[model samples]
Target: MAREVFDLSFSNGFARTLHERALGDIEQDYPWQSLEPSRYPPLLLARARVGWTENAFNEFCTAAAMGQMLQALVQARAPLDLIGMASRFAIDEVLHIELCARMAMRLGGGAPIHYDPEDIVFALDPSLTPLERSNELVVRLCCVGEALSFPLLSGAMRSASHPLSRSILETIVRDEAHHGKFGFLYLDWIRAELRPAERDRLGKAARQTLDAYRSLWERGPSHVVAGVTSEGFLLEHVRELGWMEASAYAELARVTIEESVRAPLARAGIML
Candidate 1:
């Protein structure tokens, strides 16, 4: 399939009800009107909008990945509770997608982002056993991705001066607390079935996933617009608008990978 521009295609009537049901009373209102996108530099707003759009796309991918996990769990005859949790996780990711896209819109509308629908979700190897397949997906999505996301988002939340940005990050980090733990839960449930060789393979797969994540941080400097480095005022605006400086962001990513990701996986017997 050809790539298409990303769109939420949201509806206020039915969607509002669905959002309430999925998020319950915890879903609070954001003061979207208070956001002054014009206060920031146009280039800065442009960069932020693009980042938010990317975030929305990533959330879409995560929701799809969670759906795949839910199906795999059902096929593997995983515990009923685990399957139910996976279903809930998918709903959470979908909510995140809307939040991210709306954040982009608040920043002066979402930037153009084209994505291949079929290629958005990660593709697992068909040759793996049913149990192994579930393990790989959990490790890739939850263990590494969600685990690293928690601390990074927490840092972002702390750094966020804007109320809307802080609220969104806080909500995401709250849900991610469960998401980050899901892999170990799944692993514990299936530990008896995994052999030494299978564990080794999972470790290797996890390492590759970590490498991909690290690469994103390594590309951080490229995202910085021209001349922002020499302008202290512009840098402060970036921080106030809820973005970490490039060096700090990269350093945090490294620490998060070690403390939040690698250590947890090692404890789960899936060392990377």
Candidate 2:
């Protein structure tokens, strides 16, 4: 019955292949060299110093959340291959926290991570089913979180004046690409399994998440440590990258979520 409850191990090969590819991809996509350091504020070194601390705290929160999600997936009897790959991802995220901390230190400040653990880990809707939970996790954490990070980190890399900062952003970008790929693959897999109604539900869910992500990016606390607000400048740059036009940005957000989540859900016959 029910396809004999497919063994978690059955997905191991796929997970391993994807994991190894992730490593290779990161190595190949290093972005430090392409970044120019001349765009940052010259006088706000102090703010930069504080910003890095805030960044490190935020990264720590991210890593903790990822770790919890991975643990949940494993406990839910997810494919061993997927679990294994996620295990590695958990480790990678932990390292990311450490790396961000070091970067903050290099920038000359240490902002303590003050977020409530509940706020970071159980931030999702409690009413969702396991499948919905999984969908939400992949969309929020992988697609929106990591996807948005790509452009943000790229801008940061380009604006970094210090060598360490440049290297840190480069390393992060490489790892994040792999993390984003996980969302892509999982969405693909789920799409093939969902019904039409489920697919529609997913589409609505995805749109809501994207809107939330946009709001977070636009209004979230800034990292400007030197008493200078970089929000206007940062938003200006993002606009230059085509993220300012409501229609265009919405399309990009939809495309990104669809490519990583919806298409896969569709393939699986999931509604929305």
lDDT per residue for candidate 2 within 21-64, as digits (tens), equals 64444333433344233454433334554555666666666777
Model 1: lDDT of residue 1: 75
In model 2, what is the error at residue 70, expressed in angstroms? 1.5
Question: Quick one: best lDDT, which candidate?
Answer: 1
Query: Model 2, which residues run further than 4 Å from truth?
Result: 1-43, 125-127, 158-161, 215-272
Pick out the ten consecutive residues of candidate 1 with the lowest summed lDDT.
222-231
Give the distance in Å from residue 208's predicted Cα in candidate 1 to where it truly belongs: 1.5
Summed backbone clashes in each candidate are: 0, 27
lDDT of each: 0.81, 0.56
RMSD, one per candidate, in order:
3.1, 11.2
Q: After superposition, which runs of candidate 1 have C-alpha atoms over 4 Å from their true positions? A: 11-16, 24-28, 216-233
TM-score of each model, in listed order: 0.90, 0.62
